[model samples]
Target chain A: MEFLRTLPNNLLIYIIIAHTLFGIGLYDMMFRKTLIGMLISLELMLQGVGINIMSFGTFLNPEPLTARVITLFLVGICAAEAALFLGIAVAVFRNYQTVAFDKLTELRG
Target chain B: MSFETMVVNIYVLSFGILLIQVITGGLIAVLSKSLVHCFIGLVIALIGVAGIYYYLGSPLVAAMQIMIYIGAVCVAIAFGLSLTRKAGEEGLKSPGPRAAIPPTVTLVMLLATLKGLSDRGWINVPHKINEAPVGHMLLREYLLPFEVISILLTIAVIGAVSVALIRGRT
Candidate 1:
């Protein structure tokens, strides 16, 4: 019970959680059939990466400001990416009427 | 139990709950058929990430995580979902045997790497906390990049609007 209570302080536990998020995101990215679903997976992957960087910065680094700044930038980038991707998804849906992966195979040779 | 120990236990319990929130939310986002549910799950997962950031000692980043992810991104996604018809579909065609391979491989690789990483020792350095506030650093050392990001955001929003509007006249 004491050991369980201390799990939050350990670097390994943070790494494991970040990795689990990454793995889940990767699986979903591959398996999801819609572009928006892929976008959701991509966000998860980015969140995992952010957590990994922040944990490493918190524990291993002498200074943590750089990590925070990087994270801030990551958030900004995520917002931009989400806007662009969703806009594209909307545009694609307007054209094709469906955004399903199997249905939109017009480029297939 | 000692007073300090009880406090520590409470903190740990909260952390555990946040961890569960993140994992469950991610699972919900991925597994649900409805886009609305997926966005809801994403919002929950992102909130958990923000909490984790706060636990890591940066309230600034944590706050930004909430503002950008929950406030901005999720709303944008919801708008997109609303514009598109049949947002509840889970891809039309039946996923064959090949569809199962990638997630299986991901799970296998995750387990293998977890085994390798769990036993490894990482030397923790005494944290040298930041002397300057984040806003000061952003305006000083990170000014150029900060300006670039703002510009990029402006251009992205404009471009998004243009792209979405382009074929509408056709």
Candidate 2:
């Protein structure tokens, strides 16, 4: 019971959770057929990485700025990546009429 | 139980709830056949992650996660989906059994390796933790990276618009 109360305060628990999230994202990234679904998986993975970094920063680091700054930049980069990727998705859909990964085979070599 | 004990228990309970939210939301996002359902799961997961950030002592990052992920990115994805998908699209195709093996193996390997690493004792080096405001560091030390990221965002927005427009035209 005491251990249960202290679980949240532990660094290892957060690491495990972060890893689980990343694993889920990896699974979906490999399994999802559509481009948007892959994008969603990518977001999940990014979230996991963010959590991992933040936890390490909170628990281990003496300088807090590094983690917060990195997280902020990560958020910005992801936003930009999403915009560009969705635009590419839209273009691909326009050209191919479907967002399925297997269907876009024109450039296959 | 003592008052302190009660408070601690509640904290742990809420933490558990947030963990459940994140895991369930991730599962739903990945397992759901419908893209819209996936988006909903993504939102729930993002909210839970925000809660986690708060618990980790970075409320600013939590707010940023909510605003950027749930607010901007989600809306953009929704727009992209609506624009690309047909009116009555029901679900996406699920990968075959053979295709699932790679991800499963990768996940297992990753977790195993990480667990091994965690077993090694990590030192939490005792020092004076700098509690400087985020904005202070952003403008002073991280100014270059901040400016570069802003530029990158601007370029991305413009590039997205141009790419979509060109594709639509052609």
Candidate 3:
């Protein structure tokens, strides 16, 4: 109970959470069969990286502005990435008629 | 308890709840068989991330997190999900013995690296809250990258539209 008061201020806790999220994302990416599920897992991984950046900015950096600017840039990039990938997914679905990972082995050698 | 202690306690409690929310959401997003449920979990996890940004003293980033992530990205993903056909007969396959090995190895390596770094006292530093300086620097020092990103986003939009249109016509 006494340690709870210090939890929010601890950088290590954020790191652990971010790492765990990344691990979960990795697990899902490898296990999920659908493209949409893989995309969701990718987003989870990105969010974990975002947390890591914010935590470092808040606890370790002298100038917080740089981190915030970087985060803003990251958000923009993520949006663009999502838009592009969703478009690609739609196109893939239109052509192939399925979003399953195993069914997408058209180029397998 | 002193005023400072009370404030710290409140922060801790809120953070604890948010952390749990984030972890649970991530788990659901990754583990759920239903695509819609996965999206919901992603939303919850992102909201928890926004709360974390708020705790980190960046209200602006927190707001942007909600706006961009929850509003734009997730919606785009939902639209994508809707465009897809129904789930295939072979639902998510359980990881085989070989498939399970890499992620576990990666996780163990990552945890070990993080622990070693922390033990080495490499991540310690003093920080302060300063949102005003962010806006200032954005227009000054980071102006070029900012403009480039705007251009990049414009290009991405055009690309996405063209791609969708081209596929539809074919």
Top candidate when judged by DockQ against the true structure = 3
Return the top candidate by lDDT: 2
**TM-score for candidate 3, residues paired by index:** 0.90
Give lDDT tens digits, candidate 1, residues B1-170.
99999898898899999999999999888787776787788888999999998788777788888888888898888888778756455632344676676567656765885676567555553133553587888999999999999999999999899888757535
**What is each candidate's DockQ, to 2 decimals?**
0.59, 0.60, 0.63
Model 1: lDDT of residue A5: 72
TM-score of the A chain in model 1: 0.94
What C-alpha lDDT values do all the predictions have? Answer: 0.81, 0.83, 0.81
**Model 1 regions more than 4 Å off:** B91-132, B168-170
lDDT of 3 by residue, A1-109 (tens): 7666656667778888888888788887888887778888899989888988877776666666678899999999989888888877777777878888888888999
Tens digits of lDDT, candidate 2, B1-170? 89988887888899999999999999999888888898889888999999998788777888899999989999999998788775434354556676666467656865775776666554452123444578898999999999999999999999998887665434
Sorted into a CAPRI-style docking class, model 2 comes out as medium
Candidate 1 on A1-109: residue-level lDDT in tens? 8689767778767777787788778777877778888898899989989998888777766567778888889889889998999888888888888777878888899
Ranking by TM-score: 3, 2, 1
In model 3, which runs have C-alpha deviations exceeding 4 angstroms?
B1-7, B89-91, B99-106, B112-116, B119-128, B168-170
**What pairs collide in candidate 1?**
none
